[model samples]
Target: MSEGSSSLPLVAIVGPTGSGKSELALQLAERFGGEAVNADSMQFYRGMDIGTAKLPEAERRGIPHHLMDFLGVREDTTVAAFQHMARTAIADIRSRGRLPILVGGSGLYNRAAIDVLEFPGTDPAVRAALEHELELRGLPVLMARLQDVDPVSAERIGDAKRVVRALEVFELTGRPFSSFMPERQYVVPTIQIGLNGDRAELHGRLAARVHGMVDAGLMDEVASLIPEGLREGRTARKALGYEQFLRVLDGESTVARASEETIVATRQFARRQITWFRADPRVQWLDWSQAGLGGAAEALVANSGVAGA
Candidate 1:
């Protein structure tokens, strides 16, 4: 290690779905003496393995991983809880003298893990009211309302869950939700390497990955979880693959249709993720098609001293 390269830059491998972020994180972890900390929201659950494309134990290459396989499928997961856990895992990894590699495509989870992002205090009454409003007037009503109060946030947050959270923040604090974005300041000096893939190629890869997951017993895994109250899980039930497959189990759709929907949704999600990660200027992107990506990332860290310290 060079002078100041003593501590690795709390490496975060972020990118869209099917961009091979997990593989890169594994390679970098093996080479850089690091342990991977899961930042994918879906992968936090214990039995979501096949659908989440979670790396099997044998595939981890003997590198220790943290913050994965701990949550039950029925439990609701919050970013606040994850932030607490992920930060603690990173600190523990550093104390053990190993690098901490944060990996996943869940943008909020990734940001929550490393950025100086704070979660606003929630009021159950406020949250319930928002939830009720979401059920009645639907997303458009809330979106329009948010546009009135915080157009910047309204433009950036596209989903109902996020919009509701932002609205909850605004109603509770009288502040625009966009104002809370941490200006990309890291709680710890961090190196975020985004995997960039060609759009057409990425789409093809995601489609194939969806097929592979289905072939790997995704339906069966989801079936087993139904008894475990997977449907009641506010967060888990909304997961990409699981959500579609649940429709299949409900007899509302065919497996073929579910698979197709998952592929299309995953592709759309990848585009959104690419856009999100690209907006951050701090990310040092790596072209996945390029040769020696792992070596290049190691060089990026080695060349910069005290990056994560």
Candidate 2:
């Protein structure tokens, strides 16, 4: 844990979607001789470009980005698996004498990369039973059952899979899922820089971004992925734009309606993201619109007094 192990602190850039997190990460990476380790879960899928807002290679300015576009559309990943992948990428970046700039709006994924978090083991029989119940009784029924046992986890978890997982954990270990929530402690030397702005302005930015993606052929991107098994993907099929576009492919919805639905869902997701990052007291916040924003963020990293810096 000594010597070069502590050479540079892991730098994490976190914020809501459309808050310019990716741009800020690139700036700090370029200024500090760093490479990026992505924490955005959706960006892990290989062809989810325009919808996920994955920075194209030409726009990356030749800086290497890890842990993105490494998964097929039909594949899924757990936070535990992503934690290992992210930490390995960080170590690899550091070993090459480059700081690891961890970037994205996926709060839990980011925390798993740098925080002192541990995942609970799963039980096959318990999982199989819970999944059977999910299939028979539906998600809302399972969610209701989880709320009775672990209300805190119920409040924080929304999706069907996570709700089932929370219940599974409670059953397997006799512990509330929220009891395992990670503290603000870091597993390694790390700093978090958060970007934020006025809510109204962000809403407009997000709406426009969604429209831009639509004009940039998001439908085509979704169409192309169908042949590659987008519908079969548990995680990828549920992504914001991809889900809506899938409806369009099924002729169950119109493009305009799908686009509107995607915008609304993205906004809701962004609100959740904001709430998640704001709960972390260690994050140093900067306005996304701040003048000399890059300099301000760079100063925070430079003055952090971590070994190599």
The TM-score values for the models, in the order shown, are: 0.94, 0.95
**Best TM-score goes to which candidate?**
2
Best by lDDT: 2
The pairs that clash in candidate 2 are none
What lDDT would each prediction earn against the true structure? 0.86, 0.90
Residue by residue across 1-309, what tens digits does model 2's lDDT show? 233444678999999999999999999888888889999999999999999999999999989999989999999888999999999889887776678999998877998899888889999899889989998989999989888999998888788778988999999999998888866788778999999999999999999999999999999999999999999998898999999999998999999999999999999999999988998999999999989999999999988864244
Q: Show where candidate 2 strays beyond 4 Å.
A: 1-5, 306-309
Candidate 2 has a TM-score of 0.95
lDDT at 104, model 2: 91
Least accurate 10 contiguous residues by lDDT in model 2: 1-10
Instruction: Score candidate 1 by TM-score against the native.
Output: 0.94
lDDT of 1 by residue, 1-309 (tens): 233333556889999978788888888777767789999888888898999889999999998889888888788768999999999988888777778889999888899998889888888899899999999999999999999999999877788888989999999999988888867789887888888967888888989999999999999999999888899887787788899999998899999999999999888888889888999999989888888987787777666563332
After best superposition, candidate 1 residue 236: deviation in angstroms? Answer: 0.5
